[model samples]
Target: MSGCVFCRIVAGSVPSFQVVGEPSGVAFLDSRPVFRGHVLVVPRPHLETLTDLPEADLAGYFGLVRRVAAAVESGLDAGGTFVAMNNRVSQSVPHLHTHVVPRTKGDGLRGFFWPRTRYDDDGQAATYAARIGAAVAPPTRG
Candidate 1:
């Protein structure tokens, strides 16, 4: 954790473009943003991947992500939000974090992430959402 950049940032050993700093986690503007108002939210304690994060911390970590997402949406007046996280493979940092990117319609964000597929219809979309929702465990009390 000591040599990890995120951990160093959380420890105040490294300077970051901090947006919000909370006991639960820290939110900061991405130094290399895909677009304007790109933010990253990271847990205070070092975690290498999503699976490494403790269940007890999910609510608070996700609460911070939600808060940052709202800020990205409202602050930039974006049409919507793009929230994502990579695991061990594409993850540049070994720490657990989430990317909250402000998105606008027709912004020309192409293939690497754009052109999202839509469900065949509302029913199919609902089914997929429900399936993932059903697997979600309720947040445990801290």
Candidate 2:
């Protein structure tokens, strides 16, 4: 946890293009995005993979993921979204982060071979973050 970058991001030590932060998890724009509005949702505490997440926390964590997926589609005016998680293989951060990528028709995203991209500048990343942040629904009171 001390050296994990995602933990630092959740702790607000690292500056990130944050979209949403909840009791369940925090969502932010991926610096190396597969698409313009690509977002990564990670648990507040350090968890290396999906299986590492506690069962009691699943609903809260995934509930946030669900909202972000929808927000990515609506905020970016995309047709749909691609939601995925990697355990160990290709798990860039070793944190239990879910990727919610905006998708549209004829986008040419062939398969697992994701073509990565970046924002022209920090302002562009912030703009995308704001859009998704605005579109994310408030957490339900239960």
**Residue-wise C-alpha lDDT for candidate 1, range 1-142, written one tens digit per residue:** 8889999988888876676777778876666667655678999998889898899988889987886776666555678878999998879898988987668898888645634333455454344333322332333455
- Cα displacement (angstroms), candidate 1, residue 46, comes to 0.6
Residue 8 of model 1, lDDT score: 92
- Error of model 1, residue 62, in angstroms: 0.3
Clashing pairs in 2: none
Best candidate, TM-score-wise? 2
Model 2 root mean square deviation, Cα atoms: 0.7
Candidate 2 has its poorest 10 consecutive residues by lDDT at: 133-142
Pairs of residues at least 3 apart in sequence or in different chains that clash in candidate 1: none
> Would you list the C-alpha lDDT of every candidate in the order shown?
0.72, 0.95
Q: Which stretches of candidate 2 lie over 4 Å from their true place?
A: none
Q: Give lDDT: candidate 2, residue 96.
A: 93
Cα-based TM-score, every candidate: 0.77, 0.98
